[model samples]
Target chain A: MQFKLDRRVHYSKRMLIATPVIAIALAVLVSSVLLVLLQKPVLLTFHSFFIAPFENFYSITEIFLKFGPLLLIAQALAVGFRAKVWNIGAEGQMIIGAITASAVPVYLVDSTSALLLPAMLILGALGGMGWAAIAAYLKTRFNANEILVTLMLSSIALQILYYLLLGPWKDPMGFNFPQTVMFQDEALFPALFEGVRLNTSIFIPIIFTIGIWLFMEKHFGGFKLVVGGLAPNAATYAGFSSKKAVWSSLLLAGFAAGIAGMSEIAGPIGQLQRSVTSGYGYSAIIVAYLGALNPIGIIFAAFFLAVLQIGGDVALVSADLPISAVHVFQGLLLIFYLATYTFVNYRLRIIRPLTHSNTKPTP
Target chain B: MSTIEFFLAGTLSAATIFLLAALGELVAEKSGVLNLGVEGMMAVSAAVGFVVTFESGSHLLGFAVAGAAGVLVSLVFAVISISFLANQVASGLAVGIFGLGLSALIGRDYESRTIAATEGIAIPFLSELPLLGPILFQQNIVVYLTFALALCIGLTFKYTRLGLAIRSTGENPHAAQALGFPVFLIRYCAVAFGGLLAGFAGAYASTIYTPLWADGMIAGRGWIAVALVVFGTWKTGRIAFGAILFGMVSLGELIAQSMGARIPSQLLSSLPYIVTIVVLAMISTNTARMRLHAPFSLGETFDGVGPR
Candidate 1:
């Protein structure tokens, strides 16, 4: 109704911090309606949709199971986002990383070691970085739009995954599915706890996230990159190369996404499949933004989105809402997030002719 | 889809989608607000357009509705990025995400159902020409309009006073602002125009190509068009060239699959995106060209309240 922003408020910090919460709240409200559409009671559905996911350790582990790669990709995109370099190909990078990391266990199936798993993880990270670098170089050198270039390049990475899985990586011993040979026990990620589907890959994203957060907060390198993104002229005057910032941010993001891809393949998936793509990269775009590009925030956003995902699947089985319906809910969440963000930023006004008859300003 | 026929169809389809969108983007970039939500706008428009055509069986009305729908969505992006001075990338990303969700939700009923699309309007004698004839002459009226619109847009930018004003606004908004040009209005107009094209592009894909709506039906075509704007280095001819090449690449995957080629089809499907990178790298390699050719005001939102 009016400009009600508090003068004493640290508006920037609050806006940044509250974005994810605001988005989640909006997502819940929209999803509740979707539940109603599915013939479930709104209150009951809200309880089931949001509350049920966190009810027990079984579901909590399920959260972490989905959270690992999402957190990784979100953090990765956050790095690029911090420097204003958007890498929207985390899904492609994830698939390629999975495919490449799967190379070790699938090819070297007989070879077994704890060392092999870590090595494969490193390879996956490298693969993602390698894939991301293509777009980064194009951006830095050719001055191409990184968002478009990176997104397009991601399709290429996905194709590589399809080619390998359908051809070279096809599992000979398994049924006629387009997939790779299963990894050896040594190449598999060790579980963090027994009786849970989640594995140790969750630690990879968290460790990288802390390292990134520290790098952004404490290091001059990140400061320079942030400055370059925020104010190019000032950054140039300060002698920080914008090109380097773009390359650094994108490369780091690529590395993280690749590693996340690796963890997904090695940890839970064990074998590569076409069903590997589940919109992790694109969804991470939401996660990264909703988290306000913060490491600590991404951890929570990842879990929340993972819950949305698993809950969507649950709603499909229990509520009998199809995947399309769940997607509609997700889409609505994105819209609600944007819509509410407008309110967060600006207070709308309804202008009317000041009629003498109805001229009372509400006290 | 044979080689010649496939190529002809793909190029026409690509032209229709890219023409107005790129032209609209050209104006915006010239003014300096790089909007990435074109894909999202297009996706939403495609759905809206399909629905309209499904109900009305009129391509003209569908195009109008789709363009209006796109503008409505883009207006949200424009206000957020241009007026409120929110982060352009963030605002655009929000616009895209919101539109995508909106499209999927609204388009649920139309999914998997084909609708009557705009039919090819064959040129009398030209249609009977050699292999090149149908590919070039036997396109729907939208195809001709898009091609002609590119010429008009390109010529206007190069020759007209308004074009100069738009160019100046993009090049140095502060200077233009000093000279009394309403930079924000110009940007709004440019964005709205771009949105119109983007929406029409989506309609072209839905009503023309696939003819049936599906979730994510536009596939990454919107992204490809955005990439082409860059790959073209902001030149109308180059953008059209890039788009046609992309169209060919898109059709090539289908061709390969149809030919019983054992090569993993996904690899071929990725050709368009890969080419976008390769072409962008080659053309934009010259820093001077990038600096000179890039729409001067691309991506930087104007606060109109003096520089922060």
Candidate 2:
């Protein structure tokens, strides 16, 4: 009645690809049981969760709209994750990004110059980088754990956002609301197509996907980062600095997250609001892992996650399901994915007990 | 009550929550596993404890159920990180996210519900003592338990063979494994214990401290507990001190807000987290001290392999 896991000498590629698919299937199966427990109509809930998101052009566009931030943040995170540099504070970084990007619209309310958008994007990226730098500096110089530092920084970032929204940035004419005024037309992102919320910022992820694919697959720097992650001692033996890996990876993630924040404010949100603290930064972590930390995989993974998010919203309205159901689904998805991912590197086996008579005979 | 007394009283309860959670994490980290799902575990247990207490009308039963719920969530984390040999950080994050979501779902119905606050027990002779008695002796049973737990844990680490085993396990799992200790099993237990305490802390928040069930009510106290472990340099006494210090700081902000401080409330709210960052950075800056105090295998996954 004993079970054991034996590590495989070579990882199975098939299992690597199949793990996510199997994990998603398993998550859906388990979630159905949860729906039953929650007393929701399982079939109808499933229909809304899996099928209804694609029912209309608006919802489909909404999926891409959500996909924009997830893709950018995940790709940015995948870079650091590949380097074993955990920057879980992208949420804070994204917040800072949004805040920094808003400065232009908030202060230069009447400006129509085209440079405003570009300047805002740059400032947003810098803001995210600045926030991430705190973590990086601590990790590199003081040997602080980046995970805790980044997370703490995110809380600080949120407070800063709240302070601004509640104090300085509160729209003077919006009847005491704790939000900024809508951005001017110059600050807003131009739509990419008619009849949808999708904007030109979609190209950022598309371009970065190719850029990351090339950087990871072909660049020497990327190879060094991989080496740093895989074998730290060997990396040091080859003269690769771990500190550089930490900085580059975190800064890259910060930059991308900053862009995500910028796009969120400029594209979909159109202003810095309390709602911008939505868990895109956290969800992107799942997206990064779900994509197996690869660019191509991240695209599909981000798309699936976006669908879940958008579909979860639909279920909230149509199936009378709790909004927390989506969070539960995501959490379950990550757990299941991690569990199934083990099959790529290990195989399960059953161990039978030896009979006492046989042992006595041998004696 | 004087402002100082009010502050001390508030600090005692606040410190208790952090202390309970931090003590659990201390044991887990000492055994060489870092469970970052404290936030999620607290959230779930908060919801569970609140709902159960609201329904059963027994705070004791609520605390017990909350601890069980915490253990259940931690078991999921143990399976993922220990059995599956997944990345501990990623696994912990997943557990955290899942716990938050699950708790929120369970708490949806109980959002507006409130429970009677747990009354502080007045020590017959001690309550008549000067300032110290009111601050220390007159507190909820859980608060006293938290202090006792810290003392027991401290004594355990210093005097017990079990403490040595845990220390050795965290210091060098491979060596411990070769010595016939079941590394994975020990880690699983440690993680589960951490969850239990974190759950108790959450229960305290929902059933006693605030005495209300709200989605996400645990609100970063779990994280503060996590930081407190590091801030204390993973020692029991220092951890208690750090918890009390943070508790005071947190309460100070509320007091400041109440006293008509001009500073934005959000800025005041951010004080504890910012302090955590600063203190963490300061402590970590002396790499020599950090390396000495921190378990060498703190976040490393242990395979069931003997030393080669």
For B14-50, candidate 2 gives per-residue lDDT tens digits of: 9999999999999999999989999999999999999
Across A62-138, the per-residue lDDT of candidate 1 in tens digits comes to 87888877887888788778888877777777777777788788777789666898788888888888888887887
How would the docking of model 2 be graded? high
Candidate number of the best TM-score: 2
Among all candidates shown, the one with the greatest lDDT:
2
Tally clashing residue pairs in candidate 2. 0
What TM-score against the true chain A does chain A of each candidate get? Answer: 0.89, 0.96
Q: Model 2, range A1-363, lDDT digits (tens) per residue?
A: 687888889998999999999989999899999999888998888788879999998889899999988998999899899989999999999999999999999999999999999999899999999989989999998888898889988988888988898888999997988789999989988987786789988888888888989999888988998888767788999999888889988998889888889989998888898878579999999999999998899999999999989888989998989889999999999999999998899888889888786578653
Models 1 onward score TM values of: 0.88, 0.97
DockQ of 2: 0.83
- Per-candidate DockQ values are 0.42, 0.83
Per model, state how many residue pairs clash. Answer: 4, 0
Model 2, C-alpha of B200: deviation from truth (Å):
0.3
